[model samples]
Each structure stands twice: as structure tokens, then as C-alpha cells.
Target: MGEVTAVAQALPPWVLVVIAAAVGVKYLGQALAEGSEQWARILGPLGRRWRSRAERRTEKEAADLVALQRQVENLSVEVERLTARDKKRGEFEEKLREYLVYDANWHFRAQLAAAGAGTTLPDHMSFAQWEASRP
Candidate 1:
């Protein structure tokens, strides 16, 4: 206590006031910085919550786009498959039309009956066999 008093008495009054002001300014700046940091911490979660929702929405949109693209690709493949099947069916119809024969006298039915065929009964004969079996 005696040493502190001696130091205070030795220093000029203006120097003491300058030191006191410097200490006060330093503490004030430190307090402001700490308060600003606390406010940032308090608001940080709210900012993050809004950002997270926006990010989730963006991700969902991207997923929907991918699913739509996949569906379009699947639809394109199905259309191609159906088109090919229709073309094959048309070709087969044309071939069968060429192979079929008609008679005005209707003797072709008699020929089929002569070849062990029956009326209203299924037969194990292919088109080529039935054509050949005509007597």
C-alpha cells in the first residue's frame, strides 16, 4: 500500500489520468466485442434453420427432376417396344393373307374333313400342314 501510494505520488497527474483512460477504453472495446459475439451466437441457429430448409427444397427438386427423367426414358422404351410389336403383327397378318385360299364351291371344307378334320373341334395342324393336307 505504501509502494502504490509512492508510485502514484511520483507519477504526474496527467500521466495517471492517461493510464486510467487507456484502461477504460481497452475494457470498453473488449466488452463491445464480447457482446457482439454473444448476439451472433444467439442468432446463428435461426439463420441455419432457414438455410437448411432452402437446401432441403433444392435437393427435393433435383430428385423430382431425376425421377421425371427416368419416367420419360421408361416411356420412350415402352413406346419403341410397342411400335416394334405392332410392326411385327402387321407383317404376320400380311403373310397369313397371302397363304389363305378360298373356293367358291366350298370343296375345301370337304377336303379338310377327308383329312381327318372335324367340325367345331380343335386340330393339331399348323397352317402349312393344313395347306398341304388339301386333297
Candidate 2:
């Protein structure tokens, strides 16, 4: 061990420095080359295709959303129109009921008079009661 240490110590310091520098440069170059190759493998033509596919999907989703929004707006307008029509129909039905009730009352009164009945029923009596009292 002592002899080996003496021989190592006698070697020129610049020779050891040069050997260390060569090994360091070799390893550095290898690392750089491997890193560049790995990057190329991960981010080559496939990256561009993936990006384009994603963009197309986004555009399609946006178009579908706009169409759905338009459909909702049209449905809202249709609902409003139908609601107004239903309201008007209900009012017309109420008026028709009133007219029918008035006509029936006058007809009942005239029939009682023709039958020579001294007592007349109130207009509010049910049709069944009026018919039962008829001669």
C-alpha cells in the first residue's frame, strides 16, 4: 500500500486533471444525446396530431352548445305563445257558461208560465229540482 501511494503521488497533477476532464466530457455528451432523443420520441408527429384532434373536439362541443341554446330559446317562445292561447280559451269558456245559464233560466220561466203554475222557482234552483216540480 505504501509503494502504491508513492507511485500515485509521483504522477503529474496535470495528467490526472486531463483524464478527469475527458471522463466528465464523455458522460456529459452522452447525457445530452440521450435527453434530446427522449424528447424527440415523446414530442414528435404524435404531439401535433393529438393537439389537432383536441382542437376539433372543442370546436364540435362549442357548436353543439350553441345549437342547444338556440333550441331552448325557440322552446321558450313557443311556451309563451301556447300559454297566452290557453288563457284566452279559458276566458271564452267562462263567458259561454254564463250565456248558457241565462238562456236556460228564461226558458224555464216561460215554461212555468205556460203551464199555469202560480208559484215560480228561484233562478238558482238545480235543474233536477225544477223538473221534479213540473206538472
Q: State the lDDT of candidate 1 residue by residue for 1-97, as single tens digits.
A: 9999999999999998999999996565544434455533444664444445556777999999999999999999999999999999999988766
lDDT of 2 by residue, 1-135 (tens): 999789879999997899899999656554444445553345555444444555677799999999999999999999999999999999999998898799787877787895687665545646678799899
Task: Give the Å shift of residue 125 in candidate 1.
Answer: 12
Model 1 misplaced regions, further than 4 Å: 1-44, 101-135
Model 2: lowest-lDDT 10 consecutive positions: 32-41
How close to the true structure is residue 90 of candidate 2, measured as C-alpha lDDT?
97
The C-alpha stretches of model 2 lying farther than 4 A from their native spots are 1-42, 116-135
Per-model clash counts, in order, read 0, 0
Query: Between which residue pairs do clashes occur in model 2?
Result: none
